[model samples]
Target chain A: MKTLQNFLFELCGEQLPSGFERMSTGAKELLAPLVDECYTDRSGNIVGYRRAALANAKKVMVEAHLDEIGLMVTKIDDNGFLHFTNLAGFSPEILPATSVTVRGVRPLPGVVATLPPHLLSPEEQKKPLPMDKMVIDIGYSAARARELVRVGDPIVLRQSCADLLNHRVCGKALDNRAGVAVILNALNDLVKMPLPVNLYVVFSAGEEFNGFGARHAAWEIAPDEALVIDVTHGASAQTPKNKAFPLGGGVMIGVAPVLNGEVTACLLDLAARNQIPYGREAMSGRTGTNSDGIAVSRAGVPVGLASIPLRYMHSGCEVVDLADMQACSRLIGRYVMQGGAVHYE
Target chain B: MIDAIRELAGVSGVSGNERNISEYIKGQILPYVDKVYEDSLGNLVAVRRGEGSRVMLMAHMDQIGLVASFVDDKGFVRVAPVGHVDPKTTVGRPVVFENGETGVFICGSKEKKEPELKDCYVDIGAADRAEALRRVEIGQTASFLSNTFETGRKIVSGALDNRAGCYCLMETLRRVKNNSCELYAVFTVQEEVGLRGAKVSGFEIAPDVAIAVDVTLSGDHPDARETTAVLGGGAAVKICDRSAICSRGIIEDLENLAARRGIPVQRDVLASGGTDIGSVQLLGKGVQVGGVSIPVRYCHSAVEMADKNDIEAVIGLLTAYLEK
Candidate 1:
């Protein structure tokens, strides 16, 4: 039996940038044994299905994006350095002096150059560096660079998962990988027992860029209900109490206008009944997740969101607690066993 | 000594990344010294033990360079200084990474009244971000590239600032066989980054006296800032610099030894800049410290030039001082 930390390490290590989700074979292989039927969809989402005990039963869709924010090659300079643009929104501040791997003709190690503090002017020190001014050094000449790399090739930030003292780990791509891990763990139990509803699990693509994967998955599956699992911002010293959830605070139950009120109440009630620790997040508008797209897909499918508490959402060192992930997995597992109670035509 | 200086100056040992240079120096001095070993902070300490006064000869082996930080869209790599690099001096020079990959240092901005480091980038001929990333990585360091060559009596090279000092100490270690004092020839690390290595080694091997071998600026060029030293003005005995005031006893001893040995020596009173001696002076209840510096032109630039004869004089003076 593989440890949860090792499972997360292997899952998060896969380099699945937005448009490059077809390369999610590693994740698919991991998901293969968990579901009765697992395959990659046309829209680059890994979909797994487990039939309910009764035929033609109602379906419950569970999803987490497989893609993480990364960089893409824009232009190669005459000197053989690489210029890049972000695939999704990420803070430019975390990039300097960070290490990345350019997924080109061959995987090559690269570094983001940082101007030494000794050279900084008083005024230049005050502002963050603009992305356009940054480039990656790959130690190749222009001709050799052209031979080895091409424009639009994805660049993945490389950082090994560091195990913390508590049941916590930190590394790149934990945003939805933690959610994926929760689903994988839940599927281990869901597949063995008789599920009350047809289970449709989607490891989505482009959730960091767009909601195309979830939107398409929801339309195709057209389930009676949907559950979107992802990572929510964990509160830190810098983050406000209302803006983020705390790590080790168990699962975060999403409550918003678009999310199904009955489904939200069901999840909250189940958490209390099962004694699964959970926190409530009140969003004024869209949840800024795949839930938004899935809710309105195919003349409105009701959605419920359960997120793992994660710190440093979009950097190379996003942190997540195993306890929270297990809690999220258990909550969803119980909800699936209960047959996803509230359903509409 | 000039040949050794040329050889040593060709290698890169940028501040934190001093392993290669340390290994090179360790191999070179091992045969001549009694015992040689590297310390925790990468200082190469070659000692010839004796029952006499504990004397230390410290020289920094690290050089100033740029660390790759951000690569721009056009595959141009922006860098931060690893030490003190004047953006003006670095423009249009070639830089070599530890892997021997070369890049052309160029400034991209036109809005500069005086361009700072942010305006500069290293062009490795990468066509785009992907192409550039296939070769270079972030946090990688690069040293100024210059082949060591001699014109007339002057030798020009990059990293000559402290390599010349290292060569001077290595020669003295080789020559002073019948030494009356305990000699600790330490090729220190990170002197360009505030004399870090010397501080650790100085406290650990708290000697009776410490002498830093390094390069000092010469005022022989046009619009020179320094007035007291010149390119061929022999080994400059430090009276005072920004870092430390030379011990009076050690200064007198070095000067008298130079007179007896017929070695050319001059008094150095640099208004700015410090070396390993500064940190050594403050170590272990305060050790008596002095410096023996080779006068070099264009001190921290790529084309740093030093007089061959002055390098020899420094070697002779240190050899005589240690042998006595």
Candidate 2:
């Protein structure tokens, strides 16, 4: 039997942009070997099914978003610079001098431009340039740039998953791609054992812009319950204690008004029984993830959220501990395979 | 009453982590009420059976505090505010964790720019990350360490904003012997973050009349914003706040009860801020809703002050109204 960690490492794919997640195709290929059936929904979500042996078994949906924050080209300037706006939340301060991959007629490399300090006045040096003021220099003339790229083309930060100091890895778009990896790994493990519930593994799309994909997916599937996996802020020297978690602390279980109390307790109890390390996240209002949209979908499905701690979110050098991802996968796999009779209240 | 307020104020019950305070309150109110239970959202619901109307009285049991999100290698812990935690009141303050570990809160920068809550950290005196992990785990909450003290006729504590209301509710539940209505005294959860607990419990209870007992800002200080409520001005009968416009019938009924019983009352019109009354007003088939507020000074800070007489007035008015 193959270990879950090995299966997850094999499932990690290229970084995907928000609203343009081709990760579903890669996910389908990985899931093809394990599940009984697989398909894609209208919203571009990938669904894998493992039918329960019993006829009256409850349907459970486990989902993770396939989208990541990126930028979109708005205009090309006379100087061959491309003006862009963010597809999701991005700190303007981190965009300067960052490398990007612009998907146009052909993939093109570009770098965010920064004004020289010598040319700037003292007051200008004190403030970071706004997103509209910043431009991407693609080493092309205005006419050449127009031929190579068009307005509304997606541009993603260029970074590959690489090892960091403490069993951690740095890359772009780890916020949700890691979550996708967890679902794939968990599903791979579940196929090895007898399943008690009808499982639906959905790799949802367009979570960064809005939860359109998750909302539609939930409405269509109408599962008894849902578990959403995403990324939460990782602890850093500068990050606030309450808003972040340690990179390797374990998976975070969300506690919020929208999340069902009994389901959350079940997940926590499963983690404790399995000796899996986990943390608690207190979401007073909206969870700001796909879970928010999925919770109120249709007749209101009970939703639970599990998040891996990620550092420098929406930046070029986003980091997460690989061990945390594995832990999250293990917890999900155990809960789905062994979680007995979940009661929603 | 003072002892109950002090005891409730001393316990830490940050939003989403109200188990400690909820259990404490369950123990205290279980003996007085006919039935006591907790909701799935951690709301402590105690019932006193009677006749006529089913009345729901709410006071949130949770308070604002810092939740440890991350711990660095050097033992410094990063925290996020559970509610509206002002950075000014957090710096240099001693914070106590749920596990009895204490830490000193500090800001990461020494610059003149106002620091956001994210720019704060807690130093728990651990030598390294491993030591810090031994004492505190990620996602654990730590509240400001403050002791209730009396100056003149006022009492000051860390969580007086809502715990004082909790004390008022418990005291009313104990004192009201001839209640004409079926009373559901609910100590709600997660009110510091939003009116979350009240939202769920209100939908379940669906009472005939609802009243939120909470602390409202008192504009008696020299620097306070313009408002009609003042310190030691008796119970502030809410006409309206940001949360809800108190039902006219409920407001008049409370005022008439106070007038007949000779209990001191003050009319309040808060410009901003909210209570659970907003959620209770919108629950189920709708219900008559109002608020009885204890005017508090320096709310959402380490030192929140409430007058003893104002607290007494709230308890007396609520008890008299229930009896009627």
TM-score of each: 0.52, 0.51
Model 1 spans > 4 angstroms off: B1-324
lDDT score, residue A196, model 1? Answer: 81
Error of 1 at A46 (Å): 0.4
In the order shown, the candidates' DockQ scores are 0.01, 0.01
lDDT of 2 by residue, B1-324 (tens): 667778988888989989999989988888799999988998999999999999999999999888899899898999988888898876888999989899998998877588667779999999999999999999999888888888999999889979999999999988999899999999999998989999899878878889999999986789665355788889989866656645657888998999988898887766568899777664433466789999998888878999999999999999999998
lDDT of 2 at A237: 96
Q: Model 1, residue A272: displacement in angstroms?
A: 0.5
Fnat per candidate: 0.00, 0.00
TM-score of chain B of 2: 0.98
* Tens-digit lDDT track of model 1 for B115-199: 6887888999999988777788888899988778889999898888889888888888878868888889999999999999998
